[model samples]
Target: MTNETMMQYFEWYLPDDGKHWQHLAEDAEHLKAIGITKVWLPPAFKGTSSNDVGYGVYDLFDLGEFEQNGTVRTKYGTKADYLRAIASLKEKDIVPISDIVLNHKANADAKERFAVVKVKPDNRSETISEPYEIEAWTQFNFPGRQDKYSDFKWHWYHFTGVDYDALHDETGIYMILGDNKGWADSENIDQELGNYDYLMYDDIDFRHPEVQEHLKYWADWFLKTSGVGGFRLDAVKHIDKVFMKDFIRYVRENLKEDLYVFGEYWKDSNSDIVQYLEATDLQFDLIDVMLHMNFFEAGEKGSDFDLSTILEDSLMKSHPDFTVTFVDNHDSQRGQALESTVAEWFKPLAYGLILLRQEGTPCIFFGDYYGISGEFAQTGFQDILDKLLYIRKYHVYGPQEDYFDHPDCIGWTCLGDEKHPDGLAVVMTNGEASSKRLNMGELNRNKVFVDYLNNCPQEVVLDEAGWGEFPVQAASISAWVNKETHLSS
Candidate 1:
């Protein structure tokens, strides 16, 4: 919790003209001034093509350094520009987080014929078609890279599965069981579609010792080459939990830096999240999708929503230390698959909870802070977020008190402490205007409190017993801090 906030600095619809890294470098100081402590950048390695979003990981060793995959630069920028952006952010006391996609590999150097069988997508155990020989894209020699980093030449035996077969011009999940080896069932992959480990491209098998060694080597190379402070791991649920745990440990202990690591496990069930955390032994932080869904539902339901249940079934409530909460992400912003964007009116309230509360690290989406263009039109909430982050940096602290007894309006108080005298009081409503009596400590008896949100201009003064009347407008949020703080003075 060294810093108060993290920003997801890119949207899905952003054009891939290869200038985002330079833009990030230019906005380094501006981001710091706006109270952003860390930024989660998109994947920066060379993808299947020049215009690819860097997720179709072809060569982990080539960070836009060598000419490969039909280009010398990724969709973000060249290797030099990416490194400079990271340096600029470090200079401003901001950490740059890189997205690590290690579940599969694409854009193979060549195709190889292998014996395979087709299985029912719903029940992978039941074979839908008999065994046949098909040419799969399962070779990656990296001739362009020329063994400058590592000489790990990949062939059909390196991968356990591939989605496309070039020989028959057919697309299906074919298990690459060579020399009596099968997909890693011990990884305990998703049971929904049977074997969820094979997501896309040539799925890497963690069971293979060579595969694990190659990934570990790449991890070290990526961390050293990029000089990033942390990683946002992609598709953790689809990979082996044991391997992820080892990789995370290797990153922290091997680098000898106090780095942070977060994973994207997009499940709406709190129980599912809890299960995943247990499997990984809490090695990485998770983006609480269940909590985000709660916010979205609350916003959509409006007055009819139960404000008391806003924090219910949320990882922030049960596991605060490893919960990385977010209001919306690239998938939910516009036309993606999980497009359940929270209503605009409730963004302030949603942000106030994560930023002001005593639990979870909050992430502000790029679309919300800077506004998305071309279809998803928004003026952005930069001004509101600026004020909230200022409060978060200085005034929001100490033990918390919750009054989630109301269905439409609820509030919480953070008792002022010696470190930060006269802490904070927060109130928000999903329905009608309401009031509450929160007892600030007896030491705060004569202190006056003012709403920094400004919409609720009425100032409140605590009585001799330390209780004050707090008012909140309908469908809005009001955050009150001691008048003695910097803003009040």
Candidate 2:
């Protein structure tokens, strides 16, 4: 399916400590007015404690029912309220997708105990059965380091100021600690790793059969009960590839719907990304890393990266028909935040490429449309969501097999139909204005077209020489349709 044809969803997080069903209901209406077809809500499941960001899992079945203000009456309301929110979104023709965290459980009072080393092992001494150490990103971390926080208290687990040794299970699988060493960077470890945050909690052994069963149970329950259209798999890179393969197959067998599954594989290289997609029958159908890199290069250094060509190449060469494309996501936008803000100008180009391209499913970032300003401004930027949605719904065509490229000049065109010699063509340019003339020997008397971004309609009349000039602007996008092929809708 083309990016324009599929339902575009926004990633939304409801504060665990704030609002109620009424507020969520109101928010659903706001999303509808802006043409969002779906809202990706964070995990509604009950956690070990009131750590506002809901990833710290305690009870998978609780659904936020047994906490302080979680009486089905206070903020975030009840399970019924959650259902109401889902129904409300459906009423507006929008689907509600719940964000699920299946990688690890909360460090605080873990329900399942894997194993803990009484005597620290050598070589892999930093390994722990559970992720007790708090990193800077978690809520329990000190003021500066928010990601790290211990999942449990001191008595239940071992607390060592130094990094915990990596552990090897009896089955010979390596399980790394959840401390700073467990993260991707050493700098993140130095700044956030601390004494009180040393305790490690459970990290599931995916090699075990029981663990697979546990995951399947929740997957079945969620699909049957919550009625979500798809899942945004969190921390997919951390889990074993075999586990993901089986897990995706199990979910597909049970749900039997056109379910979409994407992952948070944070990398830019197409070579690295193609492996993950090949591993599963349903690996992350879409990824956001490449676009995030492109956005960073475009916004930060004002680099002339041809986003359209890059997307086309990624889709055509690597993983076709199963890629998710997006400009910005929750994590990256929050960190390197753009200031001048060309969201409105950028969306038309981004969507034009995503929706018209034939290679992958296109994903529209939430904040890009909603205009999240203020302190959230740096973290959440959705300023041009409406305009993008408008163009996506009206102007762009669905995905097709034939895609034409002008990579040298950082431009490409997607043709919806080619056989009839009459089709909708979307043209995009990056920071360069150039013109191209097509040789249409028998195709004469064609109507000259201008894209939605163009203010005035500029018509090109074909002379007896059978040549016409197509002008594209710098750092902008445009789309054209042969007048004969215009859709009535």
Candidate 3:
């Protein structure tokens, strides 16, 4: 089966809470029951001092093994625990996709090259007599912190409007910065620089050939050791494009299968997404911004959303192969007050729109299925899991046909086959209750059909229109499928 036809297995954070291994195992089982074939987990490596959402990398190999909580090991348990998690998931045929941070390293206790030296306070020497000379550690308020410096001199790039001294020329091995830009621009710049609100130890010289080898080593280790099926490439925009191209190629060649690689190309426009798609193999198969604005925003702002035309136009014109489509993700939420609170009621509409259309591979967010609560109250994850899996199994893999959207009614039809003439049709309304005739003249007369959501059964009357009712709730989704065989009828 094509990747597009497979059901997406997604989890926001596996082992979200440190001691929830049992709970995670149970969640995996639930996902398996619903036909989810793959799972995406947050970073599982060692982070900085604090857990800090698992993005701050102290040692990628250690995998979060810290000597806290009675030497219990990592934040989410030991490497054994992670292996157990993956093994359990594998038993259910669920592929695990791990989130990886390769852009930079942690700043705390930075290796020696990053340490700033104290020249005579007023010395204005343009060039150091010995460029590699290490001066006394009286540079900043903190003294005798030599062990904190990294092995390589680090350079800071301008981020969040903070301008550092630009490198004009190369002096020996390291690039020399004139001076710090200013204090005002540097206030929150440190947080913006690193993965998880820590200063970066050193800006990786991706241009260096060794850096490429180092990245491949990590990739090889991750795939071979952890049994990961794919990767979610973090922070692609900040890294050099050439490096990404080479890195993706190396991974494609080295990794066992046609490994899935989705980069976080957070761009607002389709044009910008197109560039990233052209560069990377399969960057986010969904354009996150458009999904937010089109589905979530449409639901939030009201079913009579004015931006539907803009969304349709943009999606229809873009690169369809790499677009990963979804309603809402971990970062954003878009839906009505009641619909947002109760997400199950909203899936048939959102999923109906996404899976039925042929723009890109559809990704169902974890919250949409498992019914997230507390911090994730808006995401009714489990509420829609069964229904979504059913849709994926029965409808999504079928041959897709015309998708028509009217001012009041939006509908699409998916046929079983050209010769068979059996199929499913979904229609949604954004306005008052009305009965409209769908142009399904090709369907056989007296064929029984079922509305899966409501479990209401009806018969298709060809040439004579099949009647459907719009709910008084302004906007709602309904689906219908033909039950009788064309040959028998």
Candidate 4:
């Protein structure tokens, strides 16, 4: 089987012209040709406005179909356009995964008086003020939809917290006081900022039976309506773990059995992610954030960073099957809240480590592939990234051998398989030009190899023992492939 690759189909700075779905429909074939087997599309629902990047989710049922939040189309396009884009991807055998944000709701339609206590900004578990009456924007009536799909309306009682108190003209973490409303169990969530339950806007209280039923019904409705093959869950760490787990299981069993569900549990500690996995019973995959942090650190430290420890304490090393490795994403891109942009100088090396190795499933960032627009506009690595994708699709396979002995340089090789002959070699360096004699196996004896990346303009001839010395330039990566196989292909 060919190596599977996933691409984030949208960037953080995409134009708000509502043509993204149209562009995606047109670029389906191009994405398929570039060896992308899966695509994680941005949120398809209406945000606070047409320009909102979908994270500020206003209406769950509004997929650019209703005239809510001052627009009929989202940052992407209309609901029909979104469905068409999914169909186009399905036609090309690429699975479309919709980004699902269920942790909170934003842009409420009305303000309702509710009793709430203010919590400390640093520690959410500690209340800073007594419970008092406050008019908070916690009512989501969806005036435009008018209960078209579901008659359920969200009120202050359905949520656990709100960020802004409209009555008092104050802004803070106000924990909603109700009969049975509070943050999720601390044991099930990451212990960040005392309790990480409240993320933004009005935090959804999954403990409420009504809210739970509503979300489950919404999930079913969305799957049947959108025809997406999978879901990319957002803010899993801040959500109720029990509900999240049962929700995924319910969606898979009731909707589609093969529905792929991955979560964005953005934490750099492997132990924290392992705890989440354990809490959820390992039912889904998580984005390998520690590996991305390692890449960022390596790029920041240059030669001083130990390349040998790149994979240590990473989900890619601990739980490879549950890992979705990525170098950068919309959240980590420049100017974002979680901005930890990997140094561009080490991008080639970082890409090689994720793409060429036999470890976690790699995800190509849209910003890195198509370039970022708007305020922080930057050029992309399209030329080199395309070559790496081609190599990953056609040449990356078989038993792997690592040569991570040096701190400044590292290399690895995939012994060729029957289906993919003349296996490839990858070498990367941060300090200076270096070489590593990696074993290509006796099966690959006397096979001549050349740098498919074209970074090193030289070829290496394997000896009778199937050993070849691979060279890489300073602060760059070289992917060596069989010269004959590369030329023929």
Give the top-scoring candidate (TM-score): 4
Model 4: lowest-lDDT 10 consecutive positions = 181-190
Those runs of model 1 whose alpha carbons end farther than 4 Å from true positions after fitting are 1-3, 486-489
Q: Write the per-residue lDDT of candidate 2 for residues 1-489, one digit (tens) a residue.
A: 213233333333334444545555777777666556656666676654554355555445556444432232323556677777778877877766677776555543322222332223332334444543222111122112122221222121222222222332223222333222232222111112221112233444454444566567767776777777778776666555666767777677776456666676654566556666665654557564665455545544332554434553353346656766666655545433332233445555656556555456556655564544545563433433444454455434433332334542343333332333433344445556655554323344345544444422565554565344655666665555454333332
lDDT per residue, candidate 3, 1-489, as tens digits? Answer: 423423333333433456443445667787676666767666676665433455555456655344421233345656677777778888887777777787655433322222222122122222233333221111111122222322222233221111121132221222222244211112111212221111133334455545566567767877888887778776655556666777777777767657776666554566655655665544345344555455655565554664235245244346666666666555453332223321344555677666555566566776565545654455454544455455555554346544344566666566554443455666665554433345443443445555555533344454435333322223666566555432232
Using lDDT as the measure, what is the rank order of every candidate, best first? Answer: 4, 1, 3, 2
Better structure of 1 and 2 per TM-score = 1
Output the better candidate (1/3) by lDDT. Answer: 1
Q: How well is each residue in 106-209 modelled by candidate 4, as lDDT tens digits?
A: 99988899898899989999998887999988889998999999999999999889888877788889888978877888887668999999999999999899
**Which of the two, 1 or 2, has more lDDT?**
1
Residue 431 CA error for candidate 3 (Å)?
3.0
**Residue-level lDDT for 201 in candidate 1:** 93
lDDT of 1 at 97: 95
TM-score of 2: 0.69
Best by lDDT: 4
Overlapping backbone residue pairs in candidate 3 total 24
